[model samples]
Target: MSTQKPIRKAVFPVAGLGTRFLPATKAIPKELLPIVDRPLIQYAVDEAREAGIEQMIFVTGRGKTAIVEHFDIAYELETTMEERGKDLAVLDPTRATPGDIITVRQQVPLGLGHAIWCARAIVGDEPFAIMLPDELMVGEPGCMKQMVDAYEAVGGNLISVLEVPHDEVSSYGVIDPGEADGALTEVRGLVEKPPADEAPSNKIISGRYILQPEVMRTLETQGKGAGGEIQLTDAMARMIGTQPFHAVTFAGNRYDCGSKTGFVEATLALALERADMGSEIREIAQRLLRD
Candidate 1:
């Protein structure tokens, strides 16, 4: 039997009140924001689906029900489309079979750690993946798929890491890398939002993580860290030495849709890739540049 434990469930912590996007986010969850035509949450869920995750555990907060509804059957809409012969294929991405998706309320906005901890009841004792919908990762095989492949080979915790500019390291949780062999880097330590100069390495932790269940137990008592919230990195940091910890360098572009700049960039980048609108969007960009 393969020593690697199967990662059947993926947790999506979408409870954060997206303050950065202001009035736009005041009504809609940030995860519902579009990257091209698809909502940001769709990308994350689609990535998890591609990675063979059978169940989606959404740690949601109030007003975040839309994220769950997005994956549900749109009976009226689908019936109308079918009756009109409008081709229901476009609605395919929005539908999820019953029992495949589940949600638990994170009634409070504690932190990412707390948001993840809220899903503990469903996670049980198996290894699971966490995908931050705000961090939209784009790759041919999908970021989660890449991590799943690595997890099967190593059979321990695996996090996606991206080599960013040193100056940008302080804004992220960076790894104290022990050794690197190709795309996999051994994680010695993790410092969340350290000063740029004090950072151990520029390889910052991205959104995707395949973590052991023990980390949930560690988070049960994890003290607040950085910005006075229960930081997930703090919990994962404490679990570093107890088991295998490594970072997989993501072979893809990561767009931080959590911020305005990153969100706009992601929108334009993905929009420019569309078959029907690529030329039109490019021309608009060219016109704006000329004016």
Candidate 2:
């Protein structure tokens, strides 16, 4: 067994107002939005579970109850499905054991740093993961699993990064790199939303993160950065030299479900990958393109 602390918990910050989706999101939590058939949050949970995460910590706000209930046992629904001879196995990935899942209210719309800091008590002193449900990553081993395997080898904070176009660097947290080996890049520094001309590298931090408990301590005193909010990048940047901070360049397809375009693209991509819907979806795509 590795002597490094085992990562058993994952923190999910799902308290966003999701204004981008407008009236549809007015009554529904954006995280509950269905992509292909499964809700966005379900995919994130599935990735966490695949990576051996045993406990889920959701930092929620008001009007986010649907997210909680989605993971709970739906007695009536299950009974109906069973009576109708429907497969219960399909729901397995969506359900969680009673004590395995927990939620804390963010209460206020602070930045991502404050949202994560809200879960400090539940996360305690162990190394934990931070997964944004908005970023749906599809891979053979799943994104988190790949990071977990890398974490076991390096034993420090890990964040998923992807190389975006240089002009788009201003839209993301760009990394100042050092040494590199394979998929791992030494994150010497981080610049959040820097102008394209000033960005150190085109690699931007993606939504998946494997962070240490010490980062919570750094977030405690982290001031507002970038968009006048306590940005998680600021706190994480402070930990770069103090700990083994590295970025894992994900080798998979990452769909940003946080935006309208990305959401539609993810739906189509996933639908095309499904055995039940692939043929029909492909045909529809071909027909639409020819029109």
Runs of candidate 2 exceeding 4 Å displacement: none
The residue pairs found clashing in candidate 2 are: none
Q: Give me the displacement of residue 223 in model 2, in angstroms.
A: 1.9
lDDT of 1 by residue, 1-291 (tens): 568889999999988889999899898998998888799998998899999999999998889988988888888998888898899888787889888999999997788999999999899999999999999999989999999988898878999999999999988889999888888899999988889889999999999999999989999988887778888988888888889999999998999999899999999988888899989999999999999
| Candidates in order: C-alpha RMSD to true structure | 1.1, 1.0
**lDDT against the true structure, each candidate:** 0.91, 0.93
TM-score of model number 2: 0.97
Supply the global lDDT for candidate 2.
0.93
Q: How close is every model to the real structure, measured as TM-score?
A: 0.97, 0.97
Error of 2 at 113 (Å): 0.1
Worst 10 residues of 1 by lDDT: 88-97
Error of 2 at 208 (Å): 0.9
State residue 131's C-alpha deviation in candidate 1, in Å: 0.5
